[model samples]
Target: MRDDEFLAERFEAHRGQLRAVARRMLGSAAEAEDAVQEAWVRMSRSDTTHVDNLGGWLTTVVGRVCLDMLRSRRSRAEQPLEPEAPVPAAVPDPEQDVLLADSVGSALLVVLDTLTPAERLAFVLHDLFAVPYDGIADVIGKSPAATRQLASRARRRVRGARSADSDHVTPARRRELVDAFLAAAREGDFEGLLDVLDPDVVVRTEAGVTTGASAVAKGAATYSRHMVGVPVPALVDGATGIALLRDGRVERTLAFTFVHDRISVIDITTDRERAARLKITLL
Candidate 1:
């Protein structure tokens, strides 16, 4: 067989995943197919013998290609393009079925269209596919920190857009509020801590529940002083939360519930075993 034919076969093996990534990023079947084809072309032209992680490499390439396409589409001032193919009722393969279900949804696509190219790519790749920040950084040509911010921004926009008709807090505002609480706790600023908490805030811990702003603030001060590691911003089940990472693993997770721009409830998960099982990606 020809070398090109062998390469084509290898590319075909990853076609499903590649298409899924592109489809989510571009939100159009025709554009997704074009992006995947472009990725294949690039792979065929390069010597990939030294590529240890072919799947990851392809994903990064496809992601970058899609990002470029999104920028180009924006430059033209065009509307959000629709899928060229008819929307299927169902996909046979379960893995792809999940991808399709997750990617599709009129409300989500509308929200996704509002994001900038970089933000959309960052959110879709990391939040949706669990691609590491490092992998995303390479594609977006930014530092991991910048990529994290992009994803966070996109996540906030998505959340706010989805609940536009409601009272959902913007992602940026949520982070800001959470950061203020953390900062207050870290500094042992009792009043500062209470400032960000709702008057009747409730904190659920493994031991029991604590109520009232002062009580919650006191507990936060104590915990912050003894926190094993730095508390990093993260998306916990689609809500902005904080995760404490020690020795490269999550030691604890504090999921927050916000009301009227104040923290209403803090659901703390301190079970080391259970904490270790969480799929956390630091923002």
Candidate 2:
């Protein structure tokens, strides 16, 4: 085989793994594919004659590409543009798609969205993929120690979000918390809102992210005063949450993540297109 053909074969061997890393970092399948393609393009043009581990080199390349994409994405407005039609797959595999989505739970994706680009890159690479801190630091232009700290912070946030599934927090109790949150919001009860929110609670929406219990509670109280439609309990992405219905049609959805008995995260979906895509089952 020619030298180029040999290189292509090696790249194809790692494509699946590279795509998985990108998918977790980006949270968008299309963007992940783009990042992988960019990595291939860079490798095809560069001289890797001295490279010892091809897999590690390619992973670093994809990490850099994903980091740039994430930073660019954050620089843009919070309101995403209308999604373009997805490119047709050369060979569609619905099962593979389902498996990938299941592996990366929807709640986890929501928590990842709240992280900064650098924090997300460090955590996803080091914690999830086991990429060493030195390599992650190179991708984000930080010292190894700083990179480790980034991962540590991200890990804490992720743990808080996932703690909702702890055995101690029964599904019934979670629902009760959600019910209390809605009741407080509807009543414009600021103190009640604080009672159910974590001290460092985070609320994410297309508009932007708001942190701190007092801040989120203040906003919730203000929104409650002019709120329209009835908010009802629902299952959002397999977790207990709230759905706002107007004239019998769902207009918004809020997914909650509890740490201990207080809510730590609130992922609100208000964009019409995004809201329509959420799996919300009214109770």
Per-residue lDDT tens digits for candidate 1, residues 152-213, read 76665455444434667788999999899889999999999988997756565555446568
Off by over 4 Å in 1: 83-111, 165-283
TM-score of each: 0.53, 0.60
In lDDT terms, how accurate is model 1? Answer: 0.77
Question: Model 1: C-alpha RMSD to truth?
Answer: 16.6
TM-score of 2: 0.60
Q: Which tens-of-lDDT digit does each residue in 1-283 have in candidate 2?
A: 9999999999998898888788778877778889999999999999988999988999999999988887788666242322332222223478755544443553245435776778888887886567999999999999999999878867777666555456266788989899889889888899999999987687877665677789999999899888888898999888789989999888899998778788888989887678888888998
Q: Which 10 residues in a row give candidate 1 its minimum summed lDDT?
A: 83-92
Q: Alpha-carbon error at 159 in model 2, in Å?
A: 2.6
| Candidate number of the best lDDT | 2
Evaluated at residue 67, the lDDT of candidate 1 is 85
Alpha-carbon RMSD, candidate 2: 7.6
The C-alpha stretches of model 2 lying farther than 4 A from their native spots are 75-103, 166-200, 207-257, 267-283
